[model samples]
Target: MTPDHEVLVIGAGFSGIGAALGLRRAGIDDFVILEERDDVGGSWYANTYPGVAVDISAFSYSFAAEPFASWSRVFPPGEELKAYADHCIDAYALRPHLRFNSRVKRASYSESAHVWTVVLGDGTALTARFVICATGWLTKPKTPAIAGLDTFKGDLVHTAQWDRSLDLDGKRVGVIGTGASAVQIVPEIAERTERLHVYQRTPTWLLPKPDFAVPESVRRLFRRVPATQRTIRLLTDVVTELSFVIAMVHYRRFPFLAKAGEAASKLYLRRQVKGDRTLMRKLTPSYRVGCKRPSLSKGYWRTFTRDHVELVTEPIEEITPSGIRTADGEEQDLDVLILATGFHVLDNLPPFPMRGQGGRDLKEFWKTERFQTYEGTSIKGYPNLWFIVGPYSFTGGSWFGMIDYQVTHALRVIGEARRRRATEAVVRPEKHDRSFRRNLRRMRNTVFLDPSCRGTHSYYLDEHGDAPAVRPASTYEAAWRARHFDLDDYSYER
Candidate 1:
């Protein structure tokens, strides 16, 4: 039999687990969590590539309310991250309400009933009074276009869907893409692989990583005095949050900061890759540091200095059964091809079908009208449907930063709706949605809309080329706005 609930939370990653626990603390128990995976840790569980680790510092990248002072490194590894997710499940007693491997296929709202009918992959249907879509932007893997990909008589791996069983040791491996994943994977793989060919379309700024081990003594002290750990987090958070100002405001508002960043990055490149001017120039970015998300790595540049390693900046024309062919008529053979290509984030499309008012399909609705939302949480036509890390909410803040803001706001909305005996809580259609649309225009003036970003492959822009899929706000500002949000802007239908 289909189940019914007061609220249903989709996704089991950082946002989902955070949301579920937030509900429990709020005295809301009539909720369930549906996770597509059998386990928690959405990206952490799925991405088990050679050197998968968090790019953001572990000190500041954690949940603001829930701190783990025991992380081994400044940035935790993939396995450790998954372990942290497990800890949350246990700490919050979320296992009872957690439904694993229950992928939601579609969801629709009933205007008359004031409820949502959600379907699962296995054809089971359920109903809920409210829905929270926390399926994050980075869930879906994007496959790049290259001819003869299927014909290649070698193992192909997408970084997200990594095949743990397959071994690339002593193999001629060719890594495609130079994003965060490539920086991490290339260093690990190069040590073991016979030869490594890195295919780069455009190079990104590689900053020095300050990754280090957390001493046992520090952990012991943090365990004894929680306030000390919180202080560390506060300092780390302040430094990280300032990057938002540098990227969103200063880079465009003042050219000095941007020029200085470029100069420093060039000096760093020269310092890292000496005696190879061509390779150094190829690796150097022509764009600003945050034009595409700058990657931090201790060994990404040094890996290119290896005798057997080759950085191919030539345009790839097609793939052959035995090797990949470049547009310049050059060919490179490999035993394994790894795609460091990122997720399909800029599409702004839902993973499943979502229909709201008058049975209007969410995709069609977005297609026919402007993609609008109030404070990046609630939509006009979609009542009682909330999004975490949704459009304009990408503060480049810690995942916890966005998670905390949205979850806190959602709780307030839900608490008020239940207290007022309201069946539906929806954002006002015309005025509020229009205001956000105007704000989006202001974002176009930021660094993301710069000419350097225009041609680069980025997740920041949508298909229509709208810059900054996220709201260009600092973490502090986003949290403040969420805390001070007026429920009066939302309509409650009894």
Candidate 2:
């Protein structure tokens, strides 16, 4: 027999978990969390790559439902994050309503019934009044499409979908793309690999992480005095939020901050890499500081100091049978190849065939690269469907804060729906959506969206040369907006 629920949340990641918990808190327990994987922790479960850790601080990267006073490191590792998600599940008693190993294959809205008919991969059909697409942006792995890639004799892997069985000890390795994953993995591999060749499309601004372990005494003190930890977390969030003002307001006008960042990067380069000034120049980024995500790592810079590691900044023409070949007729052989190229972030929602009102597909409607919602949650045509960390909500600070805020907004919407006795509600107003996109385009002209950036093809920018993912200013502002979900912003139908 097919099961029925009031709300069905797809993918039991952080977002899905938040949605389920939020619904429960609002006295809506008839919702089920369907997870493709048997376990929770969406991205953290999939990515077990070496040196995989959160770039954001531990305090802000955690859930508001359950705060952790005993984080082992300043920047917690993947395992710790996964454990935290598990802890939330256990603490909230959310397992009873969760359906594991049930991947949603199709979701079609029935106009006659005013309900969503969702089909699982195993042919099980379920009905729900509302559907929450909590499948996160970074869950999918995007491997670069290179010629002769399949012909490679050695093992190939992506940082997101890492193969833990493969050994890198004493083996020649080739790493493609110097993005966030590359910055984290290269240092760990450099220690084990015989010869490591890093192919950089463009150099990124490497910032000092200042990552360190929290002492046992400090953890005990935090546990004893909760106010102290909260104060520290708030201070950190404020400082990080204020830093985005330069990128939002004076990107083009303010070259001083970018210059200072560059000068600092140069100093770090000089300190890390010796005996080769040309190599340092190649490693230096030509773009502004906030143009792309500035990577933070202690060992990323120090890894280049190793004798066996070589950083190659040549345009890759194609992949040969043995290894990768450059445009300048240079070819390098390797035993293993790792692609650290990021995910399909522009395509926030995948090709899952989502049909909104009037049989209009959401993907087709958003074809012009103007994927705007009222508050990054509800689309104009999509009724009763909410996106947790949707478009324009990509505040460069800690994502956890934003997720919490969105979850709260979603709960409020659900509460409103129940109170009004409405079957469904679409929280996007046409004017608000248009105005938000217009403001986003105007803001893109600033420093963060510099046209002359070394690598213009960033996750921050969409296909239409506009940065739709980044938030307007800071994390606090984002949280405030999310927490105060304006009913006026949404066009509700009872």
Candidate 3:
């Protein structure tokens, strides 16, 4: 039996778009991109809160193939990223193959037919010869289970699902979770809100964001000569890889890099807070740098110094009808409650039921055996299935670089399978295990294992105490391996 589509891509984000482009390059046309929302730009579409922008430099954050020439700032805002996504879709004519508002419920592999049956939320089932999961790491929003949260009468909003119509000009607002989203949102709303109460569980390491408007002349120059932009992109990529990526991945070899990062962060924070020891003590994180992902912002630190803005370090006990009650018995009244809580990283690896050969559930397998993937794309039993973002997949650089290399890896396997006229392609169990072991060994050298990171509650470390979210190798190594990995590692069957 033949499948309905040759490939079923599980998202329309940058990852899925990259996969689509990869498919086009490989001359494979029978594919469909299933996006859950009624639009493209996965995270960028969902997050539209105040001060939303890319933390990384725009030059490095975007795709290398389709360089964006008209960025307003060094760190472009969310809408610009969304526009770039739109540009890619239009340029590649990917809209025809995209199915919006199509949420996948589950996927099951068939041994006899060598195909996958992917069921939608409404029970619409579609069969595909291959399935590529590009449902990104930050898809599902994490909401805390605080007591009396449901009973709160005020307007409650999560940063991931911001209400654009709601007015916050003079409202008393309480924001929780000082993650990346909060770091951006708090500063934007602080001056506007009547009384902005920022509840902090733990402080984050912050670096000074070098954000500035890109001149029209520079944009024109970039447009006129693409080499200039490429040069900047290359420089940014190299600097980020050396300064941040190498420090995290090769922590054992260069522990001083992380130390220097911590020193720089502290110095920047001190300068921002202007020697306010009380505020500084409350804002400083106890964990090692890179234990939790650090953020970049010019205004996040100084937001706490405002007279109207209060940084509540007391643990939250429960939510009252009118306000939040802290453990210290202080009740802060507010008209708006914002959850800046981050996304579900490890728990929602797939965010849906997935069954492989012999009815092996993917989540169950990971829960029991720890999250394992061969080169962060293919699994041992899950034939013809690949993940653009999988365990140990992210290389701590730009999202586009991750998408590019992972797409290259997945498409290479799929392309070879097509060339061989094979119906199934699964990584050998031994090969998958070897990769997993390699990840485990390399992860020990990282800062995640340091004693200082013990109680930080970092999203990078999984339940198994492994930092599977980050690829232990550099981006260059990842790209090289994606292109040169042995094809024989995957067993292809007709």
Q: Model 2 segments beyond 4 Å from truth? A: 1-3, 244-256, 441-445
The candidate that achieves the highest lDDT relative to the unseen native structure: 3
**Steric clashes per prediction:** 1, 1, 1
Question: Candidate 3 on 28-94: residue-level lDDT in tens?
Answer: 8999999999999999999999999999999999889989999999999999999999999999889
Residue range 77-150, candidate 1, lDDT tens digits: 99999998898889888899989989888999989889999999999998999999888877999888888888
Clash-forming residue pairs, model 2? 251-447
Candidate 2: count of backbone clashes, pairs at least 3 residues apart or interchain: 1
lDDT per residue, candidate 2, 1-494, as tens digits? Answer: 12388889988888888887787778788889989889999998988999999987888787765578879998989999999889888888899988999987777776656688888889998898888888888877787888888889898999998899999999989999888899899998898999999999888888778788999999998889888788878876765654554544356666676677667777877787774687888888777777777778887867877889988888888888788999899998889999999888758573377787888777777775477766667787677788776676667777777777778777777778778877767755665567576557657556655666535567776776666677665666667877775665655564
Arranged by TM-score, best first: 3, 1, 2
RMSD to the hidden true structure, all candidates: 1.7, 2.3, 0.8
lDDT of 2 at 70: 78
Looking at model 2, report the run of 10 residues with the lowest lDDT sum. Answer: 241-250
* lDDT score, candidate 1: 0.83
Q: Worst 10-residue stretch by lDDT in candidate 1?
A: 243-252
User: In model 1, how large is the Cα lDDT of residue 248?
Assistant: 58
Better of 2 and 3 by lDDT: 3
